[model samples]
Target chain A: MSMVEKKLSTKTQVILTLLFILGMALLLWWADKGFDSYKQRVLRLIGIYAIMAVSLNLINGITGIFSLGHAGFILIGAYTAAILTLTPSEKAMSYLFGIQPWIKNLHADFFTATLAGGFMAALAAFLIGWPVLRLTGDYLAIASLGFAEIVRIWANNALTITNGPLGLKAIPEYSNIWWVYGWLLFTVVFIASLVYSSYGRALKAIRESRIAAESMGINVFKHQLMSFVVGAFFAGISGSLYAHWLTTVDPRITTMGPMLTFYVLIMIVLGGLGSITGSLIGAAIFAILFEWLRDLEQPFNFFGITVPGIPGIRILVISALFIAVMIFWQRGIMGREELTWNNLYKWLFARRKEGEKS
Target chain B: MNQEVFFLQNFFNALMLGGLYALIAVGYTMVYGILRLINFAHGDIMMMGVYFAFYTAVLFSSPPLIAAIVAVAGAAGLGFLIDRIAYKPLRNAPRISALITAIGMSFFLESFAVVVFGAVQKPFVQIFKTKESKVILNKVLMVGGARIPLLTFLVILLTLAIFAVLFLIVYKSKIGMAMRAISMDIPTTALMGINVDGVIGFTFALGSALAAASGIMWAMRYPNVYPYMGFMPGMKAFIAAVVGGIGSIPGAVVGGLLLGFIEIFTVSYFPTMSGYRDAFSFIILILILMFKPSGILGKKAIEKV
Candidate 1:
C-alpha cells in the first residue's frame, strides 16, 4: 500500500515483461539467421503446430470435451485460404470445376487469406457446434470425428473449389519462421488472456463439473460452444499456415484418421489439461521428439556401430514411452499448473520465511 | 429396365450385408449396454481376426471351417485381454478416460498390425469355394431374369442360425440373466454376488467372436482384406447399433440390415453419390444422437438429479 512498495512492484513487473520479450526476440533472431534452412523450417513448423496444439487445449482441456474432428476445421481453413490467395493467372489457367468468372480475377495476400480462412472455420464451428455439442462423452467424440470425415468427403467430392481428390497444388509459400512465431506468440498471449478472464473461469468450471456448473446457473452449452469455436478458429489458422507453408493441400492430409486427433489429444493429455504453459511445453517437446525420431532411419554410426532404419525403431520406442507415460506419469509435465514468473521467483529465492511470503 | 431383378439383387445383397453388420454390431451394443463405452478398438479386433484366420489358413493349409475356428479363438483371446488391460482398470474412472484408452488401444493394435503385417494390402481368399449358382424362382415370369445367388440364401440361413444361438444364450442361460442384471444396475448385480469382471470378459469374448465371424464373411463377400478395412465397416456397424437401439440384440440386427440396404441401394441407384456413403452414415449417426439418443429399441436411461 505504500508508495515505495507500489513502485517496486511496478518495476518488477516491467523487468519480468522485458526479460520474456528479450528471450523470445533472441529465439526469433536465432531461427531467422543462425539455424540452417531445414532447422528453420522445423522451428517454423513447431511454431505453427504449437499454436494449433495450445489452441486445441481451449476445447479439449478447458472445456473437457473429447473432439476428434479438429482436422476438419483445419481443412476448412486451409482450403478457404488457398482459394482466397490463389493467383489470378493460376485461376485462369486451371479451373476447379470452373471457378466463378467474377471471383477468378480476385486474389488476397497471405495475411488476409489466413484470417479469412480462420474466420470461415469459426463460422462453421458456430453452426455445427450449436447442435453437436449437446452430446456428452464418447458420442460427441465420434460425432465430431464423423463431422471431420464428412468435411473430408465433401471436400473430396466438391470439385469446383477443392479440385476433388487431386487437391489444391502450387499454393504460395508465404509462411516464414518470423510470421509463424509472431502468430504463435499471438495465440499464446490471446489464450492466456482469455483463460485469466471471467469467461475462462466459467469455461473451466463447466469442464470440471458440467452438471454442477449448470446447477450453479452457468450456461454450459454456450460456454462449450464458445470454447469449441475459439479452439477451432486457431486450428483453422494453423491449417491456413500449413497450406501456405506446404504450398499444397490434399484431402488425404486430413484422412490419416483418428491418428492425427489422437496425437493432438495425447499431446494435451500428456501436458496437463487446463494449463496453457503445459500445452506449449508439450507441443515443443512432442514436435522436436517426433522430428528427431523421424530422422533416425538414416544411419548414424556411433563409434563404428552402424544403426539402420532407426525411424521404425523410434516409433516403437516412442509408443512404448507413451504407454509408460500414460500409465505412470499421467497429468503430464505441468500437472495443470502454469510455469509463471511467480513460481520461478519463488523457487529462485527459496523460503524468505513468513515475513516475505508475498 | 429390369427393375424387379435389380431390386431383388439389391435387396438380397443389402440383407446379407446387414446380417453381417448386425453380427458385428451385437458385440458393440452388448458392451455399451453394460459399460457405456464405445470400444473404439472393436473394429481393429475384427481385422485382427481376419489376419489370424488368414495366417491360420496359410499355416495348416486347412479348410475354411478350421481357419474360422482359429480366428474366433484369436479374437476371443484379444477381447479377453482388452477387457483385462484397458477396460478393467478404468471401470471406476471417468467414461471418457476409458474411451481414450480404447482409442489408444486401437492405435496400439493397428500400429502393431501395420508393423507385423508390413502395412501391405492383403486379399482374403475364401477357403470355402462356393460356386455361384443361378436359382429360378417362378421362372415363367422372370423378374428381370435375375437369379438369386446360392451364397446369399446361405448367408441368410447362417445369420438366422447364429442369431437363434445368440438369443438362446442371452435368454436361456444363467450368464444371460447376469448380463441383463448387470446392464440394469451394476451395483445391485455386484451385491447379488455376481462376478462382474468375468461376466464382462465373457461378454467381450462372445462379442469378439461374433465380430470375427462377421469379418470372415465380409472378407468373403468383398474379397479384399486390408489392415485398415475394418475402420469404415466398424463405424458403419456402430452407427447401426445406435440406430437399432444399442443394447437390444434384435435391434442391432435390424439396424445392421437396414443400414446395409440403405447403403447398397443408395450406391447402386445413385452411383455419383457413392462417395458420400460414409458421410451418409455419419449424418444418420449425428441425427440419431441429436433426436433419439436412446435409439429405436433402446430404453431411455436417466441420471439422478
Candidate 2:
C-alpha cells in the first residue's frame, strides 16, 4: 500500500508542477494586459518580493541563520545596478555633489549591470560571512542589524559614490513583469534545487544541532557560508530589479529606519519558515496587503463621518497583525511542511482515515 | 574656546552621556540576565515613561518631581503588564517566538504613541529652567579657564546615586538572591520553592523604573519628547549591555561609559566624520562579538549535547 501511494504521488507531483507553472504564466499575462499601471506595479512588486522572501528563507529558514542584514545587501545591489545602468546624462543630472569620474564613464546594459550587482553583493556576503557566521543566535541578529545600519551610514556619507543621500534618480526604467517574474522563477527553481541537495541537508542538520552535525563530519561553517552567499546573491538580484522598476534608489529606502528588513522578516515568519512555497505565498500576501493597507492611512467616510487621514496607521496595523500571528500561531501558515499536492492529499484523506480508525 | 577648554568640555559632556547610557543599560542587562531574551520593547517603555512625565507635568500642571515619580511608577506598572500579557504565556515557547513578540510589541507601542500623542516633536517643559537665565542656566565653574556646566555635575551625581542603590538592592537583598538563582537555572530555582513568576515581575518592574528615570532625565537634557526618540539611545544601551557582558550589572556601566567616550571623542577629533558616529557602536559591537562573545563581564556557558 505504501509503494502504491509513493508511485501515485510521484505522478501527481509532475502534473501539479506543470499546472502551477501554467497558472503563474497565465496570471502574469493577465496582469500585464488587463491591469492599470498602478496595479501592474503592485504585481511587479509581488514578484520582486517573491525573490527576496525565497532568498531570505535560504538563510533564515533552511540554514537557521538569523540575519537582519538583508537591507545592506539590497543597498549594495541597488547602488551597483543603478550606477552601472545610468546613462552619463542621467548620472550628471542625478549626482549634484560632483559625480565620481571613474563611475561616470562606466555604463552597462541592464542584464550585465544586474548580474554584476548580484556578484558584488555575493562577494560582500562572502567576506562578511567568514567573521559574522561565527556568532550565533541573538548576537548574530544584532551584529547583522548593525552591519545594515553601517551600510546606510556609508551610503549617506560617501558623497562621491552614493550622491550623499540626494539619491539616484532616472536610472532608466527597464524592469517590467517579464524581468521580475523571470528572476522570481529562476530564484524559486535555484533555491528549491539547492534545498533538496546534499548541501541543503547539511544546512538543516546544522540548524538542528551544530555539535551533532560537526561530529557527523558536516562542514558546518562552510555550508552556512554557502547559504549566506547564495541568499545574498538572489537578494542582490531582487534589489537590482526593484531599483530599475522604481527608477530611483535612495539611502533611506535601504535603511532599517524605513523597516524594509522588518517587512521581509514578517513575510518569511508569517508564511512559515523553512518552506519555499510559504515564502512565495507570504510575499504575495504581503505585497497585496501592504498596498491594501494604504486605505487605512487615507481619510475615508465611515457612516457619513469624515475621518481624517492617519499617516502611519498602515505599519501600525501590520505590526499588530505580526504580534497576533506570533502569539496565536507561532509556527505560521506552512509550519515546516510544504504546500505540495502530496502533502495536501495526505492531510485531506490520510488524516481523516486515521481519525476514523482512532 | 581654547583647545584645552574644548577638550575638557567634551570630556565632561561624554561623562554625562555615559551616565545616562549606564542608567538605561542597567535595565537591559538585568532583564536579559533573568530572561535570556532581549526585550526589544524596553526602549519604547522608556519613551512611554517620558511621555507619561510630560503629560503629568505639562498637561496636568503637576510639579516636575511629582511627574517624575508618577512616570517611573507608571513605567514599572506597564513593564509588569507587558510581561504578564505578552511574555508570560510564551515562557515555554521557542525563544524566537518571544523575540518576535517583543519586536511586534515595540512596533505597536511606537505606533500607538504616534496615534495618541501625534507624531510631532513636543517641547518638554524644562525642569532645570530658572527665572534667572544666565546665573542658573549657565552657572559654571572655571578651572584654568575651562568651564563646567552644573547640570553635567548633577547628572553624574544622580547616576552614581542610582547605581549605588541598584548595587545595594542586587547584592544585599533576598529577592536579589532569587533573581541570581533564576538567572542561573529557572527550573531548579522554581523547584527550590521560590516564586519564580513574582521574582521575574519584580525584575521587570525594577529595570523599567530605571529606564523611566533615565527617560525623564533624557527629556530634561534634550528638551524634546517624541514617539521614536528612544530607538537610537535604546539600541546604544543594548549594545552597552552586550559590551559589558550582557548578564553582568557592573559590566553594563563600564560598557556604557566606553561607548559614550568613543562617541564623544570621535565627534570631537574627527568632526568631519561625525555623521558616522552611530556606525561606531555597531563596529564596536561586531568586534566584541567576534573576539569576545562572552563580553567583559559575561561568563561563557557550555552547551549540553
Candidate 3:
C-alpha cells in the first residue's frame, strides 16, 4: 500500500508485460518453424479456443449476459469469410447446387475476409441485441439459442449463399500460429483493458445489479449491447481462424451448435468465468484435453488385455467433469481474481517480512 | 392419390405427430413450471426411454407391452436420479449455475447413450410381431379416400387418454397440489409443510414417463431408433410448450398441435422448403417471444428488478 511499493509495482508490471510478450513471440517462432504439423495445428486451435473463451467471458461472465447465440454468429463469420476468401473456381466446385453469381465471383485476401467476418457478426449482434437483450435470465438464453438454431437451419437451406449443406470446401489454410496467437493476444489485452477501465467497472455494476447500474446513470442496455457486440466480434474472428485452420466450412451441428457453445462455456467456467487469464488457462487445458481424449476412441492397451475403442467416451468424461466442476468447484481456477504484478509484488513483500521475523 | 386425399393424409400425419409432441411437452411444462429449470435432458431422457424399450424387447424378447412399461418406469427413475444428483445440489446456487448444469446433464445423457447404446440406428418395431401376421398397429384405415394407419388413430386416442389421466393427477392428486404450490412459490410451499423435494421428484418422474410414452410412440411412427432420435422431438416439444405458453399444461398440448400443423402444412404447401422445416418452428418461436414473450396462454410475468 506504500507509495514506493506502488511505484515499484507499476514499473515491474510494465517490464513483466514486455517480457511476457517477448516470451510469447519466442514461443510462437519455435512452434511455427520448429514444431510438426500436428503440433502447430493444436497450438493454433488452442489460440482460437482462448479467443472464444475470453470473448465469451466478457458477455457471459463479466456482463452477466447468458447468450448462447455465439455459435450462430460463428456460423455467420465462418460462412462470410469462406465465401469472401474462396476463389471463383473453389466456389464453383462447392456450389454444385448452384450459387448466386456475385458470391461466386467474390474473392478477397485472408485478412480482409476475416475482418469482414468479424464485422458481419458484429452487425448481426447489433441488429438482434435490441430485442434479445431485453429478455432477462433464461428467457434470454432460450431466445438466443433459438436464434442460433434458426441460423443453422437457414444455412443448411440457403443454397445460394451457404452452398446448401455441402458447405464450402478448399478454404485457404491461413490460420498459422502467427495469425491465431496474434489475434488471441490482442483479444486478451482488449478485453482485459476494457474490464479494468471505468467502462469495465460500469459493466461489472450492471452485472451485479442492473437497476442499480441504471440508477448510477450507466446505460445498461448500451453497455450490454456493447459487450455483446464486442464478444461477438471476437467470436467471429475466432470463427475465421477456425475455418482457415480446418480448411473447410461445413456448418454442421457438431461444428456449430449448442455443443460448440457449451464447449466454450465449459472452458470459461473452468477458467473462472470473470478472469481473462483464467479463461486463457482454461482454453489451453481444454484444447489439450480434447485432443488427448481422441485417443480414447482409438484402440488402446490395458494392463493385461487390449481394450476396444469407445467413440464417445471422451465427451462423456468431459461432460461429467463439467457437472462435477459446477457442483464442487463453481468459482473455477481464478474465482474473479487475476494473476497480476501487484499481487505478485505484495506476495514477495510479505515473504521478505516473514523471512526477517524467522 | 387425389389432392384431397394427400392433404387429408398430411393432416392426419400432423395430428398424430402433434399428439406425440403434446405428450413430451407436458413433461417439459410441468418441470419448468415447478423447478424453473429447463430440464435440457428432457429430450435425451426420451431418447433413453426408446433405448430402454428397444433393449427390453430385443434382449429379453419381451412383449411390446412389457417393453413400454419398463421404459416408462426406467425413464421416471432416471429423471428422479438426475434431480437427486445434478439439480439438487444446486437448488440454492445461482440460477446461472443451475442452467449450466442443465446443459451439462443434457450432454451427459447424450454421450452416455452414444457410448452405451452405440450410435448406429436400430429397428424400433414392437416385440412378438411375426412377419406373416399383420399386427393391428400395422393395419391401415381408409377414411374419405385417405389411407391412414390404425397406429395414427391409436396414437391420437392414446395421447388423449394419457392427457385425461394427467389432468386428473395434476388437478386432483395431493402430489399435484404440492407441485402447483411449489411452482407458485417454492419457499412458501416449503414453509407450508409441503415436501417440496418430493413434489419436484414426482414432477420429474411424471414428466419423464410422459416423455417416454411419447418417445415410444414417436419411434413407432418414425419406425427407427437412434441415440439422437429424441433430440429433435425434445427440442420441438419444448418450443411447443413455449408456443402454448410455458408452465401451462393445456397450453403445451395446444402449442404442440399448432406447431405440428405448421410444420406439416409448411412442408405440404412448399415441398422445396421441406429441409427448412426446423427453421419455421424457430422462426415462429422468435416471433412469439418478441410479440408475446409469455406465450399464447402464459400469464404476463412482471420482472422483479
On TM-score, the leading prediction is: 3
Model 3 alpha-carbon drift over 4 Å, by segment: A1-8, A347-358, B1-6, B126-128, B131-134
lDDT of 3 by residue, B190-284 (tens): 99998888889989999999999999988888888887787788888999998899999999999999999999999998999899888888778
Q: What C-alpha root-mean-square deviation, in Å, does candidate 3 show against the real structure? A: 2.8
Q: What is the C-alpha lDDT of each candidate?
A: 0.81, 0.87, 0.89
lDDT of 1 by residue, B1-305 (tens): 47887898788888999998899899899999999889888998999999888888777777677898999999999999989976787787777777777777777776677666756777777454433212211122323576666666767788889899999999999999999889899999999999988999999999999999889878866777766778888888999998999888888998898889888999999999998887888998899899998888888878775
**Ranking of models by lDDT:** 3, 2, 1
Clashing pairs in 1: none
Clashing pairs for model 3 are: none
Q: What value does the interface RMSD of model 3 take?
A: 1.0
Best candidate according to DockQ:
2
Candidate 2 lDDT tens digits, B1-305 = 88988888888889988888888999888988999889888899999999999888767777677888999999999999988888998899878778778878888888888888888999875543445632434578776677887767877888999999999889889999999999999999999999999999999999889999998878777879998888888889999999999999999999999999999999999999898998999999999998998889889878887
Name the candidate, 1 or 2, with the larger TM-score value. 2
